[model samples]
Target: MSEAATRTVTTPPGLLASLDPLLREWLPRQRWFAGKGRPVTGFSLVAATELLPSTATLGLYHLLVRAHQPLLPGHVGAEQPGDCYQLLIGVREALPPRLAPALIGHVTQGPLAGRTVYEALHDTRPAELLLEALRTQARIGGLRFERDPNREIRSGLVPRLVTAEQSNSSIVYGDTFILKLLRRVVPGINPDLELPLALARAGCPRVPPPTAWLVADPEVPAGAPQPVEPYVLGVLQPFVQGATDGWELALRELAKGEDFVAEARDLGRATAEVHTVLARALPTVTLGHSQLRLMVDGMTERLEAAVHAVPALRPHASGLRSAFTALDDLAAEGHTWTAQRVHGDLHLGQCLRSPAGEWSLIDFEGEPARPLAERRMPQPAVRDVAGMLRSFDYAARSADPPQPEWAERCRAAYCSGYAEAAGRDPRTDPVLLRAYETDKAVYEVLYEARHRPEWLSVPLTAVRRLAASGLT
Candidate 1:
């Protein structure tokens, strides 16, 4: 029997079929699982491979499984069919005491009965093996691991998993290289890898380039229209050792009651530097009347959806609608907007301040919830500016005590710095900036309502500010 065929010892008929019951319960509990609130009706294995052949003691497996959820009536997000997740399962007769937290559960009945299983990432041995596979540029089953020929892959790096509050899984190797393992994946190119490669080629030093990446390209029948999008399995990049996240840095400054204007100003310049490089490297387009109309429509649609999801947004609905409507009017008045590749998701959290006093932008993946195509599409650079502005506001409110004016000061300084670097003032276009800010705040409303109830006031205050302004 083939190694893959024999490795199905986990179950008599099949490995996935046997593990389905267990994963049904366990997948929902995982932080990376995107369909937490929804009920998982069923699961279907898209692909499975035995990375390491089963031995007397261990079996390592990789799986891509589709999780289905019941459709909700009248729900704006109900149309999403399902989400696919990448999993690395490690099986053994028994797990060590140290790996107790990684334990998924024990299989009672299967070809390999009474065996214990857990997330492979938590185990050091499996992490090393995964890195080796990437180093060798190995291809097993439907998963393909490849590395940039220009970068060197060192050996004997200690591997440890980072458990952060993110939508994916990550592993840091010897504090030298960090690899992000995409959990909930979508087809098409992920901006995280695509944008960084472009920036690197363009010689932008403000972001880290990928040293290696893994992709999943399953075969399809000949002449399939719009073939399945390749999932970015994982991304390996140079770790910024001793770099602190911008969010934490901001909080620290606030705690010390020190001015962050200078830091914020520098960050703006860094942002402009990336934006300039991106515009030169990627495709740029002029968004005319039709395009602006489409953008306005999308914002309006999201606003409506947010109002439904977050009841607190009801009172401010009129103002939000007015902001979106103004865009339509601008299009009618024959105004055109320029669109280019931008950091689709930008905030204090998406940046890193190196110990050398340099700022590096990280995680170009855009918003995880948006469609890959939408995230890849060119957008007004103002969108990124708006996101950063919102982050400043958030930092102020989330401090030991609320400091609203602190956010305002930093926000103005950031704008001033951006204008100096980009040679154009974002504040000049009030309508466009307002519209994007409104859209971002609307997104935050739904997010805060769903995830952090105590933080709902942050965005709600923004809503009121926009509402009180007649620019909409």
Candidate 2:
């Protein structure tokens, strides 16, 4: 490696002092920490801010942070850990004078950080930020906090963070809010933070608001947020529960031989609503056909590469090109469509089926690898719609552990719901819709090959259907 490429990392001063050698070692070992493995010995805080205090009694400080910490080669795919931050939102009755021993040392911190001795047992301080987050979700859902999650979290409503393998941590509360925890911590507003906020404000249904995010205060000292650093560690919002994940649900329906045309329609309508909302919500930007063309061209190349690597996906390779060409044609028509925000990673798994047979979306935080700005930009909401419509097809076939008929019925129901809502007759734009589904399948083919090969057929079958229909 070059001199500059030795690959070790350092942190800002004044953070993680009390932990000593062990503390430093412990942080990197954490499942959530991206700077794991390579031994991030030093660090600094980019910013820090105190989150809103809890609404429920006994909830205390809620702080968000941004930090500049070391990068182990294994943690980041990029050259180095891009702008990232750490977040500590625990409550402390009285902050230790020395600030030693740390909060996460034990799970006890969130349960009883800063209240009277007994209150600590029933404490809501540490996770208080989450309590307030749940309140926001409840406000949106129009429900009251009938029971405390600390005690009755099971039935009523609870906002507790659930750890996921992604770069950050997640807090799923009331089975309604899903918070994505960003590990390598970055500063500035996150795309997920910005887009959802805009979506909620724009009156888009189905998608949740960004609500509150924990960013480090810019002026905080270096090395960790110090309970006061710079950078945002997590974004909190409403969670969607009891809803069948679109991917699994679709596959199940498909395995049972059910048509998901209706499900496709509902997804279409929701996507249209999102696009329509985006068109109005965002400042419109005019772009020539060049950008769209470039993107399509790139996607085509990616598809081909993926098919070559995985023979099963090879069959969809041509369909992918055809679909891209069709979308490209739409862009080239010179209608001058407006640019608005998009659910960058919009797809089947991103949505859910509520108990009411309704749908809700999760994961507004764009693709983790993309630049924050690009991911936040508003584009045709049609893109998201396209993503879902294609998903319906995936349902018709990809459902594993298999029920083909059930998948078909699900497809039909979903389509019915979406069409009734979007009002854009699928019949009117049959070609367009087919192209969208094919495109989506192509995307899936490539996506699964790279991330989860076992699921490759999910998209492959959809392409086969679209191609067999001679639609694209």
Candidate 3:
């Protein structure tokens, strides 16, 4: 018999019913919850498994629930499918003082009625279960825990939840490995695992390879066709001890009025190295006239949407449209550009510098809100360069009394470093580079307008400048 057959996998009856009221109130407030502004009208269970039976004093439950929300202003054909969320619920007879903050609420009227349920990752005992599962390569019902047999994980390591504000939750174990758990999940292979594993196989040192990972196997009816791929739930990778993210490093240097050109140049080289390896490991294609036209159209469409969402963008719409039109003009001339599997979302916050001055890229998941298929599609390497360039501009503007000259120097040095490593500078293709940058700025403007109204000026500043430049 298989190992999974011996272990009991069962969901406590009425567990979701008991937790519904609490989750409705608690889900929207979570930092990782994507439907922030929308109300969670209801939920439907996609899958549920009891990792530890609720009959025990301490229990753990794994749940994948679809959160239903109302559609936006425009009328649509049918109700859109809601976002799916992965949740780990911890049940205890009584809550202790330390676990107070993780509390969901006391279950009022079901099998777990009167028991306390909270976020399981916050409690060390439940958190340790994850490591042990990975260590043993356990399979519980639809959940599978996998690990690299070559890499030995010790029996016991203390786990602590990362408190940083992020779209996902991470737990660091013994300063050796960190497990990034995806809060909002979709089916298929996530690039966060796919790209790093590919790079690791090619002996690329720019990314930390995943040592262990979790996947949720889809459940299908006995006679129905099965899903071809599973959902990537979390990834465990080696932690870069005593490392600082590039964003914090840049801000600190800016605060001291120190020159950041050298560091920026080195970062550029690291990025180019990774891009080279990814190109060699994955498929690359040339975006011909038809594809290039489609890409340009996508950018233009995003700009129009942003203008509709934020009235402030209306004044700059025509100017921003020129950036996309320049690319369209080039495409009409039969110009083509190489596209490869590049980092979907590359920014200062995504790069880390170790104490010894080595750089590493993390979080290949791209923008969580974007569709998985789109994030995985190949794109021009300059798309990543444009993101980094915009990041430098953001850092400069965010400083007290903005320093435009500092940004210009850093941008130039970065391009120079990239040229040294990749043998071509992104600035050489001024039209494509400018178009990608303008598209990224439009994204930032919409994000800021929705989430941080006060920071709207940051992207608006870039909009005004990019608009004025008009693909110069």
Candidate 4:
């Protein structure tokens, strides 16, 4: 790692204290903030490095802070910790007209009193500074900006902040590269960077490889044993120009009432190819009786929790419980299943279609709400298959009149395509497939009931159908 000659400056004392009031009001309103509907009690600074010194006219500070919040309804006794977030805060004596919208608030006390703070990514200079650091592999204090030695990044690509409604923030660099900044971060090797690198090394072209990435060294005690791994902050990858997200493409086709079977089939093939490579690139495990029992137990636990959270799911609870226990019944017969690393949150939105009709999968971050270890765990590929299948159902149901026939055709086509590429159709394992699908629907039910009451009908419709099928 190359170190820049610029002297590193420490964060001003009491900076966080002064910003707490402003953040408590601003953080929850952000689309990327995870602690929605919960009050931010306080914050503890994990690591703070002055990217650009406070003495400068335009100062930039990189912060990793843990936001403390109240425990969930049932997790009071559990060891639940707050979420750590990555922030780029810019400080200026006065705001420019262009940066007015990015303002976080004006500090009234402490080191930065009377100065304005705003999101740094919205400013051109700060965004350029990040790219230059990555291009040069510069190590600034605890932050390490590294790039692929083989890939040459040209200097000075214009930066544009992506305004998409997502769990994270992004910045596109002159249509050549895109940087995805993870807001709610954890201390581990994030799968977003880990899996794509593995696929790239295995010669899989279905996913884009990261060209640059940011890592934060652990802030261990002076005499304590050093941590084994650093926290992954962000990833930079080649931007697929002229690409349309699968969700948008599907909606467009559905609005026209056009057949999407061909695209759905090809998407299945793409998914299978990625899965095949992942199995070869990573270690695979066979889940036997004990493992299957544990998995079924987790499913049952989640179902009970969902039922408690959303009373509407109570009627389907019996049927869903049966779907989960059916796995246990098979385990009793000496049945086993293969588990490998997979895209934990596979859905239409995670896929992209190029202008030439080529498909590419992005965002290996998995379910952001899940623990990093759990998200990285090896799972039955049918889990991903079930996610896509549910995505098709979602698209169909989201239509004006609800296109059940279209969804069925797409689902069958997708399975056929998977069988062709994988040599084993997921439909062949009816018991496992139904179990995973049931688990996904239960999750959706809770999510919709809590976040979008109007959209509750979408997943409820699936719960009704799956329950009627008896999940046998």
lDDT of each: 0.87, 0.53, 0.92, 0.91
Runs off by more than 4 Å, candidate 2: 1-78, 81-125, 129-159, 163-168, 172-185, 202-205, 208-211, 219-268, 285-288, 304-319, 326-339, 396-417, 426-443, 463-472
lDDT of 2 at 214: 45
Taking the tens digit of each residue's C-alpha lDDT, what string does model 3 give over 221-269? 5786765478899999999999999999999999999999999999999
* Least well predicted 10-residue stretch by lDDT in candidate 4: 1-10
Clashes of each: 0, 86, 0, 0
Per-residue lDDT over 320-383 for candidate 2, one digit per residue giving the tens place of the 0 to 100 score: 5676777678778863444566777777887777767666666776666556656667655555
RMSD (CA, angstroms), candidate 2: 10.9
Residue-level lDDT tens digits of model 4 in 1-472: 5445334557778989999999999898998888788899999998999988777899999999999988877675633478999999999999999999899999999999989999999999999999998998888888888888988888989999998888999999999999999999998989999999999989999998889999998578678776646889999999999999999999999999999999999999999999999999999999999999989999999999999889898888898888888889998899999999999999999999999998999999999998899999999999999999999999999999999899999999999988899999999998899899999999999999888888899888888887767744
* lDDT at 28, model 1: 96
- Segments in model 1 whose C-alpha atoms lie over 4 Å from true places: 1-13, 75-80, 221-227
**Ten-residue segment with the worst summed lDDT in candidate 3?**
1-10
lDDT of 3: 0.92
TM-score of each: 0.94, 0.61, 0.97, 0.97
